[model samples]
Target: MSFEKENIPSGVGGNMADVKKSGYLKKLKTMRKKFFVLRGESSTGPARLEYYDNEKKFRTGSLTKRTIYLRSCFNINRKSDGKNKCALALYTRDDCFAMVADDEETLSEWLQALLEQQQAGLDGAPVPAFGKCLSSQLSTYGKLWWKPKGLGSSKNLSGNYRLCLTSTTINLVKMNCENEDWEFSVSQITSNVGMCCMCNTCI
Candidate 1:
């Protein structure tokens, strides 16, 4: 005996929707961790120091010119235990690249020298030869984050974000759309009532 069965239409659309939702949820979780939670230090460092690169190979001997921005964080006093952070965002045209720093004085000194070199218009001068030194400083509670401004939105969103820098800390604060307000507490750092300074956003 042969039996006939009714055919059911495939629910491919439903399955696709489920997959998309799951992917989105995973992305959201990753963003939350990146922007909110502090997961200690990241192990990645700057890419290999390259002076020049051909289509399929690297030209290590050729003198290459490029413009780069240095974003750094460091401590002010060499003996202090507190976290001090400062950043130098310079539009530099140079032949080398470097990493961030740990202590404030060392970072400041290196930045000062680089700025001087950039002003001198030296040929074949390294962009950031002090990268290792900078990295050492950064490993000691310093964090560096950068984005190509030309590739990012040109919107004037200063009202949506705030940056706080001190002899011991660097804080980036932004409004939370979910709560319709600023974050309750500033991450791992405690907000001092009398020491807090209002920025453009706070006003």
Candidate 2:
């Protein structure tokens, strides 16, 4: 329940070779589940909704298109109005959902509670968050980095970088260059300032 590192399925590695070979990648292609955690003022809940893919599940009629839903029922039990403090964390087939937390303790506590509830469930719970995150991250970044012939490739781009702008700056970013080639470079001072916006810590 703690999601030890060793418990993750084998084959995924630092390199992309395993991803192409493993069945996990294929499983993701057909995945239809939407899992998300809702962190609220005084309570938090984790929910999973699975929408049946018409192409994959081909039973006829309106009942065939129905979505299956499952959720763990629990409350965060926070004291005050903590919407500003509340954060949602989840994992999907594409990426790990991590809401920025004030500290590590909050993250660990939520994870522990979630795991305990999962273990107590009648049916086996979903995959561990860490494993799900890793698989999702790899699949996402792999797609971004993969280059197919003919198409201009994103392989040259680094996906980890951040881009942001304030309301006024956003307006400037949206302005037409009018055939002028514009360029901006970050200095050490600008880089430090950029970090605050990138992490959403200042906001």
Estimate every model's Cα lDDT from 0 to 1: 0.25, 0.25
lDDT value for model 1: 0.25
Residues 159-190 of candidate 2: C-alpha lDDT, one tens digit per residue: 22212222212100111112211113335326
lDDT of 2 at 90: 35
Measured by TM-score, the strongest candidate is: 2
- Per-candidate TM-score against the hidden true structure: 0.20, 0.23
Off by over 4 Å in 2: 1-88, 118-122, 125-143, 149-203
